[model samples]
Target: MGESLSQRLQHPRRSLGDRHRSQAEKFLRLSNQGEGEFSVNIQWAEQNARQALLHDFTHPENWRMLAKIKVLLADDIGIRALLSDLFAVLGRDPEYVSQLEDVSLLDVGSELLNAALQNDHLDSDIWIQSFDASDVDSFVERFLKLDLSDPRCNVLFGRRLERLWDIAGSDVCIHLGKVLLSHRPQNYEMWTNLGRAHERMGDYDQAWLCYDQAQSYAGHLTVRDDFKERMESHFDGNSSVAWSRPEISVRKDFLVTMEKLSTRFSDSVIDTGASNEEVHVDQSGDERRLENMLKNGDFSSAFFLSRRLVTSGEMWAKEYLEASKLALEGKDDVIIP
Candidate 1:
């Protein structure tokens, strides 16, 4: 009986704490190695870290370490999941989570942003306050990569998008604004951002349409009046739609051909960048001359100006030039303001 009991003790089952500690140590060993095999080490570290959490779901240290690993891997979805777990385990103990300064999980529609301003070490505040135009692409890229399915993540991303729009212009604005609208269709701020994006893209008709949608769902009279003022300011008494080109008559065959060609160009734009496309502009001395020619129905001069811009890699101007050429051909079906 003594020998049997001794043999059983040799292969004793480990407690959850002991198993979690062993996995954590293995993760640390792989993570602390020098940089030569960094990717391989990180992969192993992540596996061990995940195993640690599985063995001891209540361990805050395991959750914190896993979140750090996810952040280093640029695994946005993984980071959010770790954060959710951390937030749950550290409930009412945000300070513990906050001390893990490498990553942050902001509370949606809370005073967290204001609180962050007071905490110099807060990662979100540091990023936002130090933003520069040169860093705009990378800044937007980081957020775009995130899986914002969580409402807290969604609200945080929406705020970042609003700031990004002010600097990066229509492309970022339109992309994020549309995403926010899909999740919160009645959000006045989301509609306002979308309308602003459309307005900047030279699509006034679409802009006004978005603004009208904003007014319909607005909770405050001030919000509706603000949208109305914006719409009124855009037209400035022109009674003209931004999308309409010069009136010209063409044969049915020619119009059909143009439509097919235009469709191809539109499809190319849609295919090239499925989610994060940008608007490229190459402003030059000829911009005013091109505008003047187009306004005066001088397709000859406008064609030359647009051609020069397109050759300089201003692809956004290509559509406008194509429409001008169609107009010069005595008929255009491309513009339907």
Candidate 2:
């Protein structure tokens, strides 16, 4: 019985190898541009590669385990997996807004973009520079997912396209422009997009580097004044150059008064988890001593105080901004929960 079982239990290791090669050839044939089966090739490649997985691919939770196995066999194969997936994706819009949480798309895209840049393949796409296409304008206006917001996607996309800050899409150019004004805020080209991104973000100070830097580059008096005037109008226009969050000043004032009122009515405003008594904050700064007066609840004082804080914030926007930033950095108690 043992001898019979051994003959019946023969493993097809060599047969599997032959099958793998055949599948690989089929994958190449199916990847033709005209045939439009690249996505199919990708899927087949992934399946074939997974057949070589150390763990049972049939198990539901073994994808991560399979990846670990792939990485062991070859780091480049893992990278190819990333690029293949990116090329197959990143370009096409997915109906589902969800992303692969197991593989952070941002990190994956950044790695792929760096590889592309190292290979000197940055300027392959030119749609990044054309500001004239009315037909291909951003019809994808409404953001279905918060993560897929233009600002966030632009950053991830730009990083992936090498210096694509400038191409495959206008939104990319606009986003990279904004990234320029953050820490590396000196890259003139980035600042240009930063200006556009700021416009989209609703910040007027988000002027393009060309407008801002034109002053230095001006060789003639008339040209310098023309550029400067244009820059001024650009900032003064609908550019949404928010220094921070919306209603930021009011938010600050609301927070400050909240702490003061919280101390005044310590029993009510504290969120001890056990207590259910509620509180509110008003940033409008239009309330008075009567408004601050609380009764069976601290909510009134909290609301009025918050209102005063926010309203008062507008009067001292810049000052409040500095103080708010310092508080953020120093962990000041003036900060409201």
Candidate 3:
């Protein structure tokens, strides 16, 4: 059986993309030569083009080829959707969005794709091909400059980082994964990838935490349980000692570390507009701040703050923690102040 769409997305093969794109180009040329049935030849071209995209979505050429096919079919809506998907992969740069606002894609789809290719700043595959992976510092410096808020870009970069785990090491994955997750904590696949990186590095406790987060967002997933089973199997024939989750204090310390790492890349600054003196004078300052964070849909920050407060023996923060967890779980009834 062929790989599922999720599997292809999670583990893209560039060689497959190249092969399929070559076939697509061949079929497209044949279709344009007026040799066989035009519709059948074009449909074959479209199928191969689609496969190319599925194999390597980070490739601008693959997107452009598909967009061209869509235009040939006079699929205006498909062209718009394709452009939207391409914009998502590019991190939705404001320049592209603004330029496309009043433009007709049907009239100039190819031109727009050319413009996007020239302006793309978030193509992880391009970065991977252009940058030296062995130079971790340089690579990370370039990576940090990109807008990591888009989950699609994060996932693409995360997959690339996973491929470079041996050279770049798991720490880079953990650091950048935390940074990206701070912006879009709902990315369960990224959480799973981060967990795999940690597990590969023998950081079982941190892996458990990441897998736990993944399961939290996608309860039907068995990543956490699978991790536990793997741990158990690792110790099966070796010794009587069995693996267990880290102690509460240890887990809390891990969360603290993640919280600190996330803050380094987080763009959201909680501006209370209150002076230090006013904050010191107000007894409910932290509570108000927590409420504001929740109201702003900044659940990542809210979770960390509420957890810290609750750990410090502030009982009021317990409610906030509950509310933050509910909100994170996407409960509709959880209302923010």
Candidate that scores best on lDDT? 3
- Model 1's C-alpha root-mean-square deviation from the true structure amounts to 21.6
Per-residue lDDT for 153-238 in model 1, tens only? 34345556676666887776676565444332334456666666766676655555556546654434254356556666755676
- Model 2 spans > 4 angstroms off: 1-139, 142-152, 156-315, 319-337
Provide the global lDDT of candidate 3 against the true structure. Answer: 0.69
Tens-digit lDDT track of model 2 for 127-232 = 3343234523342221111122112132233333334433335454553333222211112233344445555554433332233432221222143344346556
Highest TM-score: which candidate? 3
Query: Each candidate: what lDDT?
Result: 0.47, 0.35, 0.69
Clashes of each: 0, 22, 0
Candidate 3 lDDT at 15 equals: 96
Could you give the candidate ranking by TM-score, starting with the highest? 3, 1, 2
TM-score of 2: 0.24
Worst 10 residues of 3 by lDDT: 272-281
